[model samples]
Target: MSSIIVTNIAPTITEQQISEFFSFCGKISTISLDHNTAAADKSLVAKITFAKKEAAETALLLHDTKLGPTSVVVEADPTAPAPAATADDAADGELRQEDKPRSAIMAEILSYGYALSDKATQKSVEFDQKNGVSTKFHSFLKDVDDKLKVRERASATDEKYNVTGHLHDTKSTLSRYFEKALDNSTGSKIRAFYADSSKHANDVHKEARRLADMRTGKSPADTPEPELASSAPVSV
Candidate 1:
């Protein structure tokens, strides 16, 4: 098989984000993202066709792995017509890892896009920079920033206080404009992101502090004001 089927996809999952996760395995020929993912109670699917059979085998390796916080099923594409369901097969039913101990409702898909993420996954996925639909966080933020102008406002606010304040790292800058992109951000997603101190953990932590330092690092206000020269002659 040169293709794989991913099921139980959160509607929020985009084609690009999924590609980022799997592209490291091999060259992908095509990725078909579900357009009707918004339908409730329906689990979406994504079909990935890789250039070679080896890629499909490697992708099937993630069959039981977590996609974000939830477990999704990945399997090699059977490529044949659906089999007629027997009583036993129907009784068994399709089981997904996320279905176990299922919650009262499906959890909100907050896996946020994969771009600008300090995660090691970014080191692998190649993204198209031209499209607003680009998987890179910059593109993601750029689209969001258009209406809210959050980055514009944040940049203005920063310059208003300290004219020279700037973050050289573009990704971190975009992260700042997005405002919620820092390490101190708390939530279930962030907590999982910080799981067990690994190299990725250290990298995110260190990068967060680095981004924080842009403002907290130095202050124009800290410099002493130059003494004012009086136009009036000094008293003899």
Candidate 2:
């Protein structure tokens, strides 16, 4: 199925940032940009639709890089109906909210919109560029260095732990697997790999879950799957 998303873009990023990032990944169908001028500061919100899910996923990961803050990729939830407006709301009788200060605008431009993030998932995408997950994973690798320092301090011989080795191995394996998954001529294999990997264990499972959450702006728990029914007719 094709994927569509509406992003609450970071203010600092421009339309070029979004286009360039997706162009690097693959072909795109459309990008609709809406600018809000009534506010004190200018902001751009865009809806991006991709012909392929892989392209969307790849493009979404770019959110944390140069395109971060002003760029986010939100999944279009088909099941949830639009909130209904009451009669008073439709008549514009609701109280007007206070405006945000310039400081708030600057902060929003700099921040990666983690507050809008899903707390349960703990994944965040950048707004300026298309390469945030790799950057985030690299940042996470710093923890391994801390672990190694702790291990060396505890050891009498000052021997570092295998944290770095493990990280390198994990990164290498994931790179190879990801290339294989995307090597299909017609994109079918890539989708199949994504589907099958969801149900089983492999090195990519944990990282895929992490990246998926970061890219999609949705929690890992929200991933869709075909639920097994309890009552089923079994015919011989």
Candidate 3:
């Protein structure tokens, strides 16, 4: 679970040179040439997953000793066992506070399973061919869609039933507006589209009531009104 990820590697370092550098360690997982053939402007990126952290550290130390200009960083999987604590370290109450269970950490990071799924959805929507919808981004988009649906439903219920509830729906709506605007590589046009669509949906609901009133010969003013906007923001 210990991997050596070499980035900003000097152009002079060839694939064979990198392979030889880590020859003392375990097998390499992947080595990729992420740069073009501009000698002074080339950078090689390689990922080497070792059988053990010590072996990986040995490779890093070797790089530090011989390859002075290159920069390499090691990232170990969170689920992997932490580096062995020394005897003096044992004197400390806890070896590490960040070593929470991987599942629990992932749960907190994802917050909701659908949120991660929504990221995948966004990727999909970005790469779609037929409709040019990116299927890779679809998971993320779907998760967001699910969350909005739930919030919208809750808002409608709370407003119609005269019930009190936290401002989650309003906050979620605004959060999505900002998040979409910020992350979309294209621009804020998509955010504007969503905002307009939301307003349109609410308008459609009102229009339906208008039609019903006309058919029943009732006054349009008889329809119940929407609630006022909330004043404060909410957090995830």
lDDT tens readout by residue for model 1, 70-137:
55678877882332332321123222121111010001111112222222222211111111121233
Alpha-carbon lDDT, every model:
0.40, 0.35, 0.36
Q: What residue runs in model 1 are displaced by over 4 Å at the alpha carbon?
A: 35-40, 80-236
Query: Clashes in model 1: which pairs?
Result: 115-137
Model 1 lDDT, residue 201, Cα: 25
Q: State the weakest 10-residue window (summed lDDT) of model 2.
A: 95-104
Better of 2 and 3 by TM-score: 2
TM-score of 3: 0.26
Best by lDDT: 1
Query: TM-score of each candidate?
Result: 0.33, 0.29, 0.26
> Could you arrange the candidates by lDDT from highest to lowest?
1, 3, 2
- Cα-lDDT of candidate 2: 0.35
lDDT string for model 3 (86-190, tens) is 332213322111221111111222221112222222222222211321232233345556665456444432332211221112323324333333332322433
lDDT of 2 by residue, 103-211 (tens): 1111222222222222111222222112222333333334433443455333422321122211122433333233332332422332343222222222122333333
